[model samples]
Target: MSAPTITFNGTIPQQYDDYLGPFLFEPYALDLADRIDYAPVTNVLELACGTGRLTNLLLERLPSSAQLTATDLNPDMMAVARKRTLAPNVTWAVVDISAIPYEDNQFDLIASQFGFMFVPDKLKALTEIHRVLAPGGKLIFNTWGAIQDNTAWAIVNKVLHAFLGGNPVPQHLGPFSMADAQVVLQALTEAGFHHVNATSVKKTGLAETAAIAAQGFIQGLPFATAIQEKDPSLLPKIQAAVEQEFSAQLGNHPLRTPLHALVFEASK
Candidate 1:
């Protein structure tokens, strides 16, 4: 779903953390956590810590003395994240990234998973991030590439569009908004982040079965929210179609599909 249309409230957070988090977000979460220099970093602010997919890995990489403040726009997501990653060093809060409520230079590093694209005003959010970060602090985040680059999701989107008679919901079209590195780099630069760099990363989106992948797509994302809002009765039909599509195209055993993303790193 498009960033504007996607909202991880209600049951969406739990399903997202359960299905999509492990299949699509975990590898990148691990990679992003691994990039943390860890030696000197003491204060970290994780924006959009959806269900703590990255938080779980990040905790492992951080030194015991490090302080982590995890924030998300949705309280439902924060609740799930809190239960998943319980630690004395971590503080969980619901925060608006556009107007972050923190003292200047409060954090040494800021990180986000596949959430950068969701911000309504990226430069405003980045400016807030820059404001809260200490000198030479870093901002690390990732965004999905074009829809075509992520084949499985792309196919699901295509199927939904075709099934719904080409009037797919905006949530289905939102996540790929910042696919271009140039746009992201410009936003970061304008927000006062220096040495901005965007790197392409590829990972395998894996599920135990085609049914699982299909179910994950249907239930674990904005697809479910959209369907629930407009036509909840059509769920079974959509799920069946998605399963059949995956089985026909990707086969049933140990489903593995490629997903492309751009990892952006900038110094504040």
Candidate 2:
């Protein structure tokens, strides 16, 4: 199917934390953390802080004095994040990125990992970030590259497409939605960001076995939600088909596949 309305609920939060987090998100989370100079950042905000993979890294990397507010639109995801990440310096909130409730110039840095793709109005969301960021503050976010560059995702998409008889359901195709660098840069620049830089990052996602990779793709992310919406009865068949294809192509032992992302950073 195309994609599901991006959601993390019920078992999804746990599954996402267990499989997807390590497979695709942790590397970019660490990359985003390394881009920041935490010594000077006293206040930080993390948008779309799903299950807090990046939040934990930020807590570890930032200065002890720094305070962070982690927010996500999904309460279930935030609940999982709060349970996983415990710190006196952090406050959790359920927030809409386009309409931030904070005061002007409230944050020294705003970091979003694989979240901007879900924003319907990218410019409006960036403007909100720019509004709440202090002068010289930074915004660092990453979006996935085109499907062709992401091996596991591409394989899943192909398999799902074929299984669904070449008619994928209509839903939010999150990562593939924001693949244009020029458009992203323009949105940031228009939102009053300066010194904008876009870099391409490539990482190998490690899976102990192709079955694990297939499980992560089939049951751990929004694609699972899509499968349920389209036809709940097809889940087992889909999972088995994807697992077989992955095992045949990627091998069963220690599957490592390429994933690409476009990391964007700018200062206000």
Candidate 3:
């Protein structure tokens, strides 16, 4: 079985921001933003600033004098982000992490939220990040933990697997690919980042209803495309099953599920 190619196009970007943004991403975005020491950060770069969840928070924390360059590979995602975040000091660009466009040692801080795992070459991306980071600068990012560790996503994955019937899981190839701490640490070290630290952070994922949560998991993510490719007609059935599972396990009318992720911080 082969993983489906994940693209943040069409309505995926808007749906992602509308559904999963607050539920799965906002908590980690707050955590990532809070981890930064913004006193000396004049120039900042954010990679894969999906819908500007963390980018908005970063702007709030940063001083008026600070400049932020937020970039993502998908213009659709960036469009949503740009609409949400409007600041005079912020510059938006379409960027690929593996080959950053900025000059060497340019940014005082580089941050990403739940984006690194999707990079095909982790070491290459980290090296590019290190190159852009100024001397003694910091890099902070987070990756989702193993599927089983994130309770809500774990349940969703199980339901998806059952529906796919022995097909490859879309998330395994992207979001959860770098779940292992050792793998992340090794990549950072090899990329020449020092004083590396990894922290396991767990947060509560909230959704208004089981149905809505199911929609987020099924349609908002790459899973939607995978399911569509396999059998578009099965999407509704799988989503219903996922909703039922969520209601049974997590509850409805303000669903609160445990989500786990690994946060990494390194100095260049």
Q: Is candidate 1 or candidate 3 better by TM-score?
A: 3
Clashing pairs in 3: none
Q: Which candidate is the best by TM-score?
A: 3
- The top-ranked prediction according to lDDT is 3
lDDT of 2: 0.86
Q: Rank order by TM-score, top first?
A: 3, 2, 1
Order the numbered candidates by lDDT, best leading: 3, 2, 1
Global lDDT scores for all candidate models: 0.84, 0.86, 0.89
Q: Which residue pairs show collisions in model 2? A: none
Predicted candidate 3 versus true structure: per-residue lDDT over 26-97, tens digit per residue: 889999898889999999999999899999999999999999999998898999999986699999999999
Candidate 1 overall lDDT versus native: 0.84
Candidate 2 lDDT over 175-230, as tens digits, reads 67778898889989999999999999999988888887788778887667777888
Model 2, position 95, has a per-residue lDDT of: 96
Task: Assess the local accuracy of residue 182 in candidate 2 as a C-alpha lDDT between 0 and 100.
Answer: 89
Summed backbone clashes in each candidate are: 5, 0, 0
RMSD, model 3, all Cα superposed?
1.3
Q: For model 1, name the residue pairs that clash.
A: 1-171, 1-172, 2-171, 2-174, 3-174
